[model samples]
Target chain A: MNDLMIKASDVGKAFGDRQALDGVSIAVPRGTVLGLLGHNGAGKTTLVNVLTTMLPPDRGTAEVAGFDVVREAHQVRSRIGLTGQFAAVDEGLSGLDNLVLIARLLGASTREARARAAELLELFDLVDAAKRPSRTYSGGMRRRLDLAASLVGHPEVIFLDEPTTGLDPAARLGLWEVVERLVTDGTTVLLTTQYLDEADRLADSITVLAQGRVVATGTSAELKAQVGQRSVTVTLADRSDLPKAQEALERAGLHPVPAADTLTAPVTSSRELAVVVRALDEVGLEATELALGEPTLDDVYLTLAAHAA
Target chain B: MTTTLTAPRTRWRGTDVFTQVLVLTQRSLRTLVSDPRMIVFSVLQPLVMLTLFSQIFASIANTPGFPTGVSYIDFLMPAILVNTAIQSALQAGVGLVTDMKNGVLARFRSLPIRVGSVLVARSLSDLVRTAAQLVLMMLFAIVIFGFSPAGGVGGVLAALALSLAVGWGLGWVFLAIASWLRNAELMQTVGFLAMFPLMFASSAYVPVGALPGWLQAVANVNPLTYAVDAARALCLAHPVTGVVSALTISAALGLVGWVFAVRGFRRPL
Candidate 1:
């Protein structure tokens, strides 16, 4: 059984009478990525702050890496690294200097700090520009440096709160590789993102939050199952055969809806495709196009968000 | 058959607080080395004040009973050092505010580091920088004016000690201001305005007796007067009372400033 890296029990937070998080509970197993999908003001960052021990929750308990956020804040902080939604590295310091500074802060010797900084520089592919002022680095380079700086002490758990929101597709892919390597090395990741594809591609388990509460959560396939199986699309060649094809689909226990020249119907199984093809043959009709799949995580995300509203 | 220890160790010694604070102080010091402009301005401010103030009052020292037998240059050296240190300390809050606004301080807030060390490091860096400037002004005072302090080595040491204390004490005021006020402009404006009033209304340039009755009373009451007076006595070998009194007032300010800064830091703005 995988060990639980983070466990929150009815965690609650309020900022000046406005409830930012209300009894939001989440748990992540070690070495697994839990993508927290939420729109703005969904309390993702608030929860991250509470779990990271940066802010004390008004109610309930949160434990990260076996350390209680309130009672053992220092230990909790030591175990996790937070890359906030915005870049926080000092612009005056060079990229190399920023990474080394964090290492030194974690009690690394000067020699070890420099050596580790060089290693991270190579890992982020910023070795050549490491000596330049961080202010001059490109947005993508700064983001990479920010991540590398956070990893200086090799934190066991990482909170990447919208880590790739502002990066282009190429830069986003580069960060994804770094995050993948971290998870592969047994690092537990609590990722929050606005991008649905990011959650689908990297999340081992997903928690959808809306209006500061978790609406639905499960694996991508399980959440997709909540939206039911996808509809099989079929385009009939002969217009006159639509009525017959529709009737044949109904006889085969399928509900067909005519969409332009194509007829579509929800399918409970992939075998429905073969059944539909046979039905088309019975109606003297041929399908010009045919496809069947399950609903995507996107569908589940929208459905859960809509319901939460 | 060996067993693996999968979990991280839990025992923490907790005695490394001072060491961590020292390391953080060194980090700020390292940044200071890269920014020489700050050093130049910090040193240059006192130098200009010293020359301008002493020169403006050169003709008056020729009169009798100037409090000390020393020249106005020697009389003004100790005050200049204290004032410089105080200014440096007050401005130290600006750096803390900058760090907070820029997320530098927030970085430490996220780490498992000593929270007090974050503000302490900034103040320590400012103290060191101001000390260098104070020492440089001392050299200038002695060279340009051909003036010698009454107690050669010990007096200079005492003067510097009193100045450091004043600077460090005022630093607490800045730290408190920086903690309570989040905006850098507000911090700088409040510190700057407060520092100048304290500087001018005190006996930093001339003896309190030389001023009008009301001005004399106000200057006499200013704690900065104690700093300047104590430093002057120590530098002129007039008496150790000046040094003792200055240090007493500075120590009190330091204690009060610390209490307030911590209180402000703990409470929300």
Candidate 2:
């Protein structure tokens, strides 16, 4: 029963001749967030759509909440919730009305629908905007309402497809906090996003996809190790020694980042620093500014995308 | 089908279908109620056409093969009643195009709702709105134009049923149109343009045989002609058999439209 909240085996989808997802397999452990990191058209939405039963996969099988997506799609749907990128609240209806409407559609009784809507509105910081038409709400507020609508059924599993692409930083953080609270309550989340920092902050595990296949999947630290580059930046004692610094770095199999004017080259270890310094001294090079740093998630994303392509 | 007892594949209970329909209906209704300009256009424009055409053809009873001495308002009332419903159904496609553009339809598709809820709920909303249109036409005919049914209560009911059927028929047709068109703004332009000429050129506002040669040939194929002719037969005089045939025709048109709508929606967007 604890196999996973979501399990897919060789799930593939295509539009006529063009493949969208190619034999992709992923497992999202229960009560944890698994981030699907991909650029647009990387088959993120296609995977979500297939799992939610909106589009059937051309090949392969997926299950959500222990129910097969194709055979028990409705049961899967009932157990899971989705918050699409766009705010899908009925813009014509008030915020409260929008939540209550979906709640009722999920088969809640009238009193329960109203109480649930009220609680959700307060939880999302939308109590003030509850009576106003959703068409008039701000983008962040609308996104909150959209996420709140997804919670109407008390789903065990939730899918958030780029929930914060077009929001201000504060709004994005607010949504992040709500997601954090949801996870603390043991909700399993499958989040797909283009933002590397978002995945870094929220995901328990990450799967990086590119060009229709999973290129890398691991803990953030583990995936970072795959494209091994931690940089140590150094400024020269004399600008003339820049010529000598270039040779020392090349001999160590380290390359400088293009925009760094001083010196930024890959470092194997802090112990190896003595070897580099000695090599630099022999080559007549010295530094004034020096520090070592691991690669950022952005660098990892780009390298993975480029490698897959 | 070995899974009948296997805990219904969908969390969707049959009763939830009604709630879904109601929610969708309320959303559609609220949008319309909020938009005063649209409400006015939907209600008033039909009434204007009803009066203008009736007054213009007040003396049409003098023509051979037409009912002599029947009031033009009475002759026009039933057909106009049906016309108002059919027009609303036909134009209901615009809302679908709007939903498609705004991603409302796609969101519903992704959710755990019943299959066909979106389309069925939209048509059901159209049905209610068209019924309101029917009441407005009835009020105008009775109070302002001094028109009442000479065929009595049964005739009025048959008239209502006929229009509702026609409205549902064209509603299905518009559903197909909305599904096929990618850009909704373009669809609105095309839908409105298509409706005006088709409504005005047919026996809806004037007898089709009275039109110029080219349009008369065109009206021969227009389905609205059959609907209006059926209503005229029901309200103004006795040709019960003709009314029966028109009902059959309306059913056939509705079936064909449903086929198109299903074909259009069964495939992925």
Candidate 3:
């Protein structure tokens, strides 16, 4: 039982002349989630492929569950599960059969395989449609089955590549809940997603990959603190009150930036909320609307993306 | 329902490679059984071709240099059989390309099983399909066109076996090509482009001597010719030269194809 379930050092991969991954490295501790965030062609999937043993890196090294991905791929494979961006369950086989086949491949007896398949179907809420061909399943159900198929072997580490990319909101939440449960039970996970909110909610730490390189890595809060801003927006009833509101906030030691019929100011503490009200009231202006905004991961992402560009 | 939170196993007992390949092969076979329309269509296409060729080539028997007493249908049955096997083998490659495009190969690669088993299972499944299709083609030829093998039942079985060997061997070749291309449309185009040349230049349809000097040279070197010639000898109860030579070539070519296919499979998708 290694504490670091995954470790890669300066792994590089190229397809022909195009370098898909350039000196990327990642490590995930047991029972935690590491979200790899990147846009398309940013090498998120390529990195997952390398870690899952589906592809060998051209340079450097990677290990999963303490086994070298190249020399000891079989051992690494046995301990890891992977749910790719597309649902990889067999389209020709029924959901139940797909799960059972994977179980049998993992060395389960026929009886045990059946039991595991039944249990997984129930867990994924796919029992009702288990006997139907997976090609007939809706996108969400197929994704669920693909996830269930990977879990049949009870892998110690799971790679989920854009698991919720095409899923509807409800289905996305369902998958997130399932992943959360897995992590709570000591399963280490490396999740790659395009959705910042998904990583913000589910990941313990986030790694941003841009053009085949890691641009940033930290907890969501830490990332926001680095490049994100907190602000309070005040909307006045009269357009003429804008200049007054701006001067009031600036005179009160707060810098308020003005927009059309409204003003936005950076706030470092909650005390600024009271300061804003008192300053605006003293200036003989009554506000119509007020809002306090915390810096979101989206802002952090945009800032980092701009810097990288 | 309560979800189990069992701790992950440190290291489970690994299944042997044979069992893994068998399991995957069984899965492929199950898909074949479930798709009745594909099976029916696959068998029907060859039967229809057999009928068309037997009727269309009825005058080839009168061509003097054609076998003295053999009907054109009998001489042509072996060619059609070998052609059908080759065509069916191409389907295996098409399936592999489809699997790669849809990420099915990625899923299989992530498993604990030997990676080579995936290609082996696909080739095995195609071998079985090719054998079944050949048997049906033979039966239909026997009843409809009065086709008969002079070497009796054993020779027919041996001929059938050779057709399957060609199927198995070429199935690997197609698999290798498909894995390398990783595109179904591209693989299909390449397969057909490659297939027409191989089948037409072979001695499957006409005697090598009857072909022009240059085409005769090509047929002499083509492996499909040995296979069709072998089957023809078996059906006519002729000397076994073609049979022995065809089997030797098939084994050697099959070995080469498997090596290339496995190497292609091991490459990154």
Each candidate: what lDDT?
A: 0.78, 0.76, 0.84
| Candidate 1 vs candidate 2, lDDT winner | 1
**Model 3 off-target regions past 4 Å?**
A230-298, A305-309, B9-13
Backbone atom clashes (below 3 Å) for every candidate: 1, 1, 0
Best by lDDT: 3
DockQ of 1: 0.17
lDDT of 1 at A60: 90
**Runs with alpha carbons beyond 4 Å of true place in candidate 2:** A229-298, A305-309, B1-16, B30-37, B55-66, B152-157, B212-221, B266-269
Q: For candidate 3, lDDT tens digit of each residue in B21-124?
A: 89999988888887857767888877887878788878878886788888888788888888888888889999888778776777888988886888888888
Give the local distance difference test score of model 3: 0.84
Superior by lDDT: candidate 1 or candidate 3? 3
Each prediction's DockQ against the real complex: 0.17, 0.22, 0.43
Interface RMSD of each: 5.3, 7.8, 1.7
- For every model shown, what is its TM-score relative to the native structure? 0.81, 0.83, 0.87
Where does candidate 1 stray beyond 4 Å? A133-136, A221-309, B1-15, B62-65, B145-147, B263-269
Cα lDDT of model 1 by residue, A1-309, tens digit: 637999998888888888889889999999889999888888998889888877788999988988898899888877777787777888778888888778777777778779778878887889999888788899888888888877776777889999999899999998888788888778889999987679878999989876677888898777667655676778766777778888998888776767667777766678778999998888677888797745654445444543444
Candidate 3: tens digits of C-alpha lDDT, residues A28-77: 99889999988899899999999999888999899898899999998988
lDDT of 3 at B173: 80
Total backbone collisions, model 1 = 1
Model 1: docking quality category: incorrect
Against the true structure, whose TM-score is highest? Answer: 3
